[model samples]
Target: MTDAPFQFFDVEVLRTERLTPAVARVVLGGASVSRMASAGRDQRVKLFLPHPGQREPVLPDTERADWYDAYRELDPAVRGVMRTYTVRELRGEAGELVIDFALHGDEAPAGAAGATAHDTGADVHGDAGTASGPATRWARAAGPGDRISVLAPVQEENGGYDFRPPEGTDWVLLTGDESALPAVAGILESLPPGLPTRVWIEVHDPADRQDLPTKADAEIVWLVHGTSPTTTEAIRAAELPAGTPYAWTAGEAATVKALRRHLVGERGFDRRAVKFSGYWRRGASEDSPMSAADAEEEA
Candidate 1:
């Protein structure tokens, strides 16, 4: 591992599965995966994918102190395609890491047959839309034995996640779209039993709803994009548990912002008590330039 807070790990896809209509799960395995440690809830990692026609990603030299600067200097078209994703589960015993991708952009046909590990370069069917991003394309086409690289934490106490509930908190609130499902699931799994927890998840399709298993006394409500009320609307209408509440919300930038404002401004929640993140904006790709305000929210 490098001497930095994050280390680069080369991995191969051990397997992949379509979890839901909008979510795909990739199980990655490599000798290096055994040494990687995650802080669990909402742990973020930088995934580097090879460009089309390349077998593996071209990454910056790990020995360098300023690896990110070196990466930025490389040719964009040839260098690795980097995107941030959550570590859904880290199974050290199995030497594997799991990541779930929310299918977006131009997607493969609903009935299309996915290629197997042996068929590495099969043509995928779908309409090519301007909104399609490399990450979305890569996830849809990824197969077993496919190569990728990740920048992950080597320590358990790494501050790469943001699901801390302060002491004296009586209840918890979690909300997000499919983009934030992995994080919400992780948080739910980590909560103590009998803790009063409320969740509001929004997804484009009802089939995207996941069976989130948690030990906590959690009340989860799924909101289909066109069929159900918005997260803010659901939260506003429901009666919340008494006492100090810790809230975590993520998804589209505008939706996250609206939820945060409602919690802090209208509901009288302490600004610091609510941990929110904008996983993506409605029409913008991750490569889009972020404004100062967006950077602040992400930070």
Candidate 2:
């Protein structure tokens, strides 16, 4: 499959807001962004940055129709590595878009690379150590007038899984890591009023817990993973209330898989009823985000 020609659009940074110590919200607006505000909440688009002294990158005009497929099919070796991030909120009337980024600390590879670059007084992109790491670095400095190339939105395949609570289902179980929080929050917000839901989120620390606005009857549990994302023991210790009929889990690759197997295979939940996804695999780089196909094969 071949990719469509690139559609170049210019967006201005309208404002930037800090959500937390680690999370930043960037708002962009422009006539070119009108269509994106109507896209789904979880939809993702690629952001291409202009290299030093280069105008915005260009795509062929004819490739626009099949851009998503062509973009995905492009040779990894030739294309600049793209980072996948969520579209947290969109406002068409206001011509606004919001994306959240998790700040990297010293322990994180991105943070460490940034630190090293600062010490050496090197250009951000020239610092090979940081440039070769995760996408977090890009988020740290992203601002308006940055001239980023954006691909059309691509929907997540696993989003079709049944998250709607059944008529008789009295309780819901939601579990995931920070990567899955956006989806979890969306799911909770969509549930019908008075539907009891329990959410368990694994974050790096207590400060990671953000108030999620939801109308559904729910309880939130946060598990901290200081210094690493593999600290799933607290997540494992969670005991769902008796008679939980629905379960949705997403997080690190290995952890989510294990939870799915345990709930469906060992606990005897219907295999078709549980929706689980691995947002990212441990040790996997952002340039190659995990896909549902990979998750299925691994499972």
Candidate 3:
């Protein structure tokens, strides 16, 4: 196999499930899926979704290094919709991959396409059309046999896997909003057994809370929207474990910066020991130019 860091693969939706009030799980399976590998924690993948009328996403030649540029040159309405998402799990033996999507505040409308054959009745919580982006809408209405494309790593050591707790680390600190749940879950599941860990997750509703099974001795806190404090505030006010620590934070760009600032400035954490990412920024679409949070995280 080629040693490229990432490659494109065409996959089809094998099934879909409602994991929580705001999260939908889509299982994709195809011949190409067997060749994909994930490094687990916070493994990033770029997914290409077809427009409503398109049979499959229209992508540029995958072999070209500048395929992204080629894709950008295409007419927006004629090109595929792209989104970044974390893989919840990879079932290699079964040739399947799972991705969990946050539905935001919208649910699939009744009588939508393929509702009868593959609808799991999972998109039942929020009103349709509220805060629903292309990905959200696609997830809401996605069904078995729906086709898509993904650019993912075939090897585990690719730069896409970012959560790395160095040796000698005594404990871990994790914070994120709903978007980071899958990454956090993957990290928790893969942590060394009996390690000290703390997690704070913010979600739109109590029903969005997921049962994350992990071997680490973890204390998890769920911060609900409007009821609980923001992720930064919650982590800031709490006392953390006394030891060499490694922290990872993701979610809204601004909030992620706040958490990183608090950890490094107020909490006296080594800047390098705290890894952060902004999965998204408020008031911005996924396709928008990088924001300050993106620069801050890189810094």
Where does candidate 3 stray beyond 4 Å?
108-130, 291-299
Q: Is candidate 1 or candidate 2 better by TM-score?
A: 1
Better of 1 and 2 by lDDT: 1
Residue-pair clashes per candidate? 0, 7, 0
Per-candidate Cα RMSD to the true structure, in Å, reads: 5.6, 6.4, 5.9
Model 2, 125-225: lDDT tens per residue? 11112232333454456576655555543223323333545567767878876556556766776677977777777665566678888888888877655
Q: Candidate 2, clashing residue pairs?
A: 3-70, 4-63, 5-60, 5-63, 5-64, 6-59, 6-60
TM-score for model 1? 0.90
Report the Cα lDDT for candidate 2: 0.54
* Model 2 stretches astray by more than 4 angstroms: 1-12, 37-80, 105-134, 152-169, 226-239, 242-244, 286-292
- Please list the C-alpha lDDT of all candidates, in the order they appear: 0.77, 0.54, 0.77
Error of 2 at 17 (Å): 2.6
Per-residue CA lDDT of model 1 for 1-299, tens digit only, reads 45566888999999999998667899999998988999898898888889999999998896688887899889988999777788999999999999987665445334222211002211111111234457667888999999999989999888788899999999999998776888999999999999999999987777778999999999999997767998999999999999999999876666788889899999999998999876665333334455323633652
How do all the candidates rank in terms of lDDT, highest first? 1, 3, 2
TM-score of 3: 0.89
Greater TM-score among 2 and 3 belongs to: 3
